[model samples]
Target: MKNSFIFLFLLYSTILFSQKTTDYLLDKKEISQRELNSLSNFPIYKAYEFSDKGGVYNLVLGENQQKITKKDTLNTKIKAICAMNDHGGFLEKWSINDLLEAYEPKETNIWFWTKYCTLKDLDGDGYIEPIIVYGSKTEYGEVRRVKIITVYKNKKYVIRAVECDLDYCRSFKKDAAWNTLPQKVKTYVDQLVIKLRKEQNLLLKDG
Candidate 1:
């Protein structure tokens, strides 16, 4: 018990000091030229896809999308996620330099994904749970994190994050290994949080 308590204390202290990532803005002129280039053409990144799904609970779309009256905006966000299939996901964008730029380049290059996932009711009480699947490029590998951002009855949350990367590979390995206890076979999963990837005309399907 004492050992567990000490371990928890250490873990809490680490989280207490952790900081959200930041996304720096390049000069519009500098960015314009690079934006024109293809995925293979650009080296330094624009802060979105290049990041390995590291941010937690960021409201880049703002919480307004989840508002009942704001259904239009919510649809827009979903449409955008569905559109990632065209010409690769290199065009995924989140330029927050105008309002806030607290997003760090390395930490998450994203805002609003969670350090640890939590549950929420983005979908109404009775309905197929709605979700948002974000696609992007990461240093280690592809990163997809699902989220349900909705505010119901004054309760709002950022929930459901399933990431695909080397860092979280252990959690995935453990789960798969447990199921195949008798015969050990390496379970390789590089895409864990991806609801859809590289599927042409993906928008035609439900998110």
Candidate 2:
């Protein structure tokens, strides 16, 4: 009995020490420029195909698309994840400087998307003060619901994103090591959050 017990313990330990393997495979999907230009709150499958389009392809449509209702808006808060960052993503490369400039309608690019969020001023403030997130599933990966908050500042609605899925965050890792387990897979959630907050605060202050 003692010998059998020792063998079982060693076996169990070996299994425990073994490295974990992931099933996540690199999805080769292409994104298009036209799709990117017309992107809203509709989920796209095979986002890798449209990756060139950039930004999350997932969108929230229908009544949810019209305007973020009050109930859903309240649930948009990050809740206990403040240490990391807010879910609404960040602005694109070109838009960063534009956002810093004075808020204006022409300056607002509805197509602009960031890991932090898609912003809009529903009430039509020169500034995109409202934060919102799109909640839905995409063809290539999981999709998150949209969070819309209407901040009553300057007698207009400011749109901003409050939440989005961390799983959707991904980037291309070129190194051979990144292709294997443990090294390649990392959540852009934290980085996205930081970037989003930094931009969010900046936009808010200016708006």
| Candidate 1 residue lDDT tens string, 39-65 | 322222221211112322212221213
How well is each residue in 164-201 modelled by candidate 2, as lDDT tens digits? 32333322122233222221111232244346457643
lDDT accuracy of residue 191 in candidate 1: 26
TM-score of candidate 2 relative to the true fold: 0.19
The parts of candidate 1 lying over 4 Å away from their true place are 1-108, 111-137, 165-207
